[model samples]
Target: MQIDPRGPRFAAVLTSAVLAASLITDSGVLLAVQALVFALGAAGRSPYSLLFRAVVRPRLAPPAELEDARPPRFAQCVGLAFALFGLLGHLTGTAWLALAATGLALAAAFLNAAFDYCLGCEFYLLLHRARPRPGT
Candidate 1:
């Protein structure tokens, strides 16, 4: 599926805010909620994207380009993985691990939100390039 290029960036802004809040509050519950968001995003049913379509997109002009959904979905999976690790730390009472993982996720989200850089998307591209071609 194709998506407005801005959609993922919009989601990233929200994700960054949510992640920052979770870090400041040290709230496992909040992190869990973000994790759910990540899970939904990975499944291509992100609530944030729905919100963007229903609410935010209506206010904006048309996008100059669209993008493949696969990369962002892969990025969501990467986010989910980190979120799960953070939750695991919370469950196991490993404060450092929880903070570290959450912090890393926050950094990634912030990069996407503020700079339009997506590390996970880059990783996805890297992996896609490394895969063997049918003719190879």
Candidate 2:
């Protein structure tokens, strides 16, 4: 089975570390960092694109045309929102909720890696197709 090249491996790493640390202590800082990572990716930071390019090309070998849809803008938004929800759960001391959200995100990434269907990305493309473009 082909895996998705753009799986959230890095984000998963960061989330894992943050979740570990969040367990032993109370630190808004860790949650903030997690949210920031998602925000950066959502904002189209170059590093995110570089990471995507690096992973997708040699590792997954998705068609070159996928670059035009790099990160799938709407998927990035969903990711950012999910991360933010996790952060909010942390701030509010909702441990189970926070963990559930984080776990869901991680599981989704793993599924994408294994099965090549990015659920969030599909939503992104749907949104992209439903909207009217500029000057159209």
Candidate 3:
């Protein structure tokens, strides 16, 4: 399925906010919440994305183009992976590791928010390129 290109960036803003708050507060629960959000996004049911579609998207002009969902979904999986690590590290008493992981997630979110640079999408593209094509 295709999606408005703005949708993922909008979601990234929300994700970055959550990540930044978790990093600043050192809140395991918050990180877990973000993990849940990431899981939802990976599943294509993200609350932020839903809200964007239902609320914000309706107010804006229609997008000029749409993009494939796979890249963004893959990106969400990457986010989920980081969040799981952060949560696990925090729960296991490895605060440094947790911070490191959360910080990494935060950096990625920030990139998406500030520049619309999707590392996850880039990674997805790289993987897609590396895989053998069906007819090749």
Candidate 4:
């Protein structure tokens, strides 16, 4: 499925806010909640996405082009991985680890939201390029 290019960026902005809160408060619960949101997004079942579709998308002109959904979905999975690591760090009493994980996630989210850059999507492309070709 294809999606409006703005959809993922909108979700990124939301993710960045929650992540910022988690870092600022040093709250494990907030981190975990953010992780759940990322997981839902990765699975293409996010409430945020739904809200954006129903309420936000209609307000703007349609996108100039639709993008394949896989890139954004892959980005979400990377985001979920980071959130999981942050959760683990919090649960294990490793402050540095948790901060690092959440910090990385926040940076990525900020980049996506502010610049429309998707590190996870770029990683996905790199991984595909690294794969051995079939019928070689």
- The prediction achieving the highest lDDT against the true structure is 1
Candidate 3: what lDDT?
Answer: 0.94
For model 2, residues 29-72, the per-residue Cα lDDT tens digits are 66566567666766665254566557654676554432334544
- Tens-place lDDT per residue, model 1, 38-67, is 999999999999999999999999999899
Judging by TM-score, tell me the better candidate of 1 and 2. Answer: 1
Against the reference, the lDDT scores of all candidates come to 0.97, 0.58, 0.94, 0.92
Cα-lDDT of candidate 2: 0.58
Say which prediction, candidate 1 or candidate 2, comes out ahead on lDDT: 1
Residues 1-136, candidate 4: write the lDDT tens digits.
9999998899889999999999999999999998888888889998778989999999999899999888888988999999999999999999998999999999999999999999998998899899999898
Residue 26, model 1: lDDT of: 97
Residue 10 of candidate 2: its Cα lDDT?
Answer: 46
TM-score: model 3 vs. ground truth: 0.97
Q: List pairs with backbone clashes in candidate 4.
A: none
- How many Å off is the CA of 26 in candidate 1? 0.3
Query: How well does each candidate superpose onto the true structure, as a TM-score?
Result: 0.98, 0.61, 0.97, 0.97
Candidate 1 residues lying further than 4 Å off, grouped into runs, are: none
Comparing 2 and 4 on lDDT, the stronger one: 4
lDDT of 3 at 72: 95
Runs in model 3 deviating more than 4 A are: none
lDDT of 3 by residue, 41-132 (tens): 99999999999999999999999999999999999999999999999899899999899999999899889989999999999999999999
Question: Which 10 successive residues of model 1 have the least lDDT summed?
Answer: 63-72
